[model samples]
Target: MPELGLDTLKAALPEYAKDTKLNLGSVLGNGQLPEQQLWGTALACAIAAGNATVTAELAAEATDRLKPEVVRAAKAAASIMAMNNVYYRAKHLIGDPEYQSLPAGLRMTVIGRPGVDKVDFELWCLAVSAVNGCGTCLESHEKTLREAGVPRGTVHDALRIAAVVTAAATTLSAEQALG
Candidate 1:
């Protein structure tokens, strides 16, 4: 794909929403993380947000930079988080001692072996958790990432990618709704 492939997605935003367009550009161009890692995180966030357009566009663009296994791991991160986020978030929010103590019984083998660098997988999980609005998952992933020696700046950049992709997807949804 072209170097500006992400720009194509960014341009899909309504021209009047200059701030969202500019934010997409900035996040996609962020240098705090490697391009591969950034795109991987974005792909996971897009998938977690259930935005088919953004997910397909990001996956197509990321294939050039990320290993196939790495890309798969990003997808797995989104899928697993989709389940875990709901369960864990409910447990946290409910705050009932009985519910919190119960075994989640969630299948999350992917977290242990995501077929990529563990930190990269964790970063993707963090991005997805952010999109899923699971404060529990977010805190867990962020702490794991930081303890694993991942820099805070890199974590921030990954979250930035998640935020921008989510915003862009919402913009596209609004565009579709207005049509």
Candidate 2:
């Protein structure tokens, strides 16, 4: 396969998703985040978006910009958040006080030892949570980021990247299904 990147993703989008293609380009390179945070958030959101093409292309671009450990931490955040978002979102939506008191019983040691900056990991998790629509997770991650002195603009940029990546993935899936 030809090397896939943002250009590939943009080209794959149907005309109806033209805005998504434009947004993808803008968010990837014009965000407030620093290089590591930008690429890490993109990679994590791409994984959470669950598009192999998006994930692969973002991973390739991220590898060129981020350290190996940071890349791993980004992937770990996506993986852990995938499970945590579902469990926590369901518990929050169920509105059962009993569920809140119960032990999660899930192994999530990576959250404690992500081998990257804690705030960066939290930001990536926040981005993934946004993609997953897990309000509880989003709130928790946002609070952690805020307490760590991360700027709201940085957080907003991360969410924008997440939104664009998820939208791109969804559009790609729709295009495939309609073909």
Candidate 3:
């Protein structure tokens, strides 16, 4: 229940000063232009992590390097998105009379093998949902994780990674054009 102090930091940071400002990339892009958005979301996640220098450094690197970092970060974010999508579908299925009646062992083979600890996965889901602007995903993950006893810090940390990765993505394009 401890505060992460993000509100205070947000209030102090300027609009562009914080590399984690990625509403444009996550909400507007809808993850269509990944190469571009990777950098933006990475920065946003990094800022959420409270590591401005490292995120900025990734941005400063040459396009070749910067692009890779963006890819890695964005890929991580996207992977979580896909995972959540699958998990939610499976969850819905479990609510059905047929799936609900199935044994746990069978369920594991069909849906649980790829699943992770709901707490851990939900934390990542929250981050990607925020960056990807999936309100339903965000709300569900947020609600579930809170109920699962995940500390707020854990959620904040995951979001920080998403923000940092998004910001780092932008440097790639800038560097590529110049390089």
- The prediction achieving the highest lDDT against the true structure is 2
Q: What is the lDDT of residue 44 in candidate 3?
A: 34
- If both were scored by lDDT, which would come out higher, candidate 1 or candidate 2? 2
| Predicted candidate 3 versus true structure: per-residue lDDT over 16-126, tens digit per residue | 545443543343233432334334344334433334543444344313334454444433544646555455556554566675455434222211222333454445456
Report lDDT (Cα) of residue 66, candidate 1.
Answer: 84
lDDT of every predicted structure (CA atoms):
0.84, 0.91, 0.47
- Write out the backbone clash pairs for model 2: none
Tens-place lDDT digits, model 1, residues 69-168? 8888888989999999999998998888898778888778989988888999899999999998999999999999989998899989888888888988
Worst-scoring 10-residue span by lDDT in model 1: 1-10
When sorted by lDDT, best at the front, the candidate numbers are: 2, 1, 3
Model 3 scores what on Cα lDDT? 0.47
10 in model 3: Cα distance from truth in Å? 23
TM-score (C-alpha, index-matched) for candidate 3? 0.41
Off by over 4 Å in 1: 1-4
Q: Residue 45's C-alpha lDDT in candidate 3?
A: 47
Full-model lDDT, candidate 2: 0.91
Q: What's the distance in Å from true for residue 70, model 3?
A: 20
The reply for model 3, stretches above 4 Å from the true place, is 1-77, 80-115
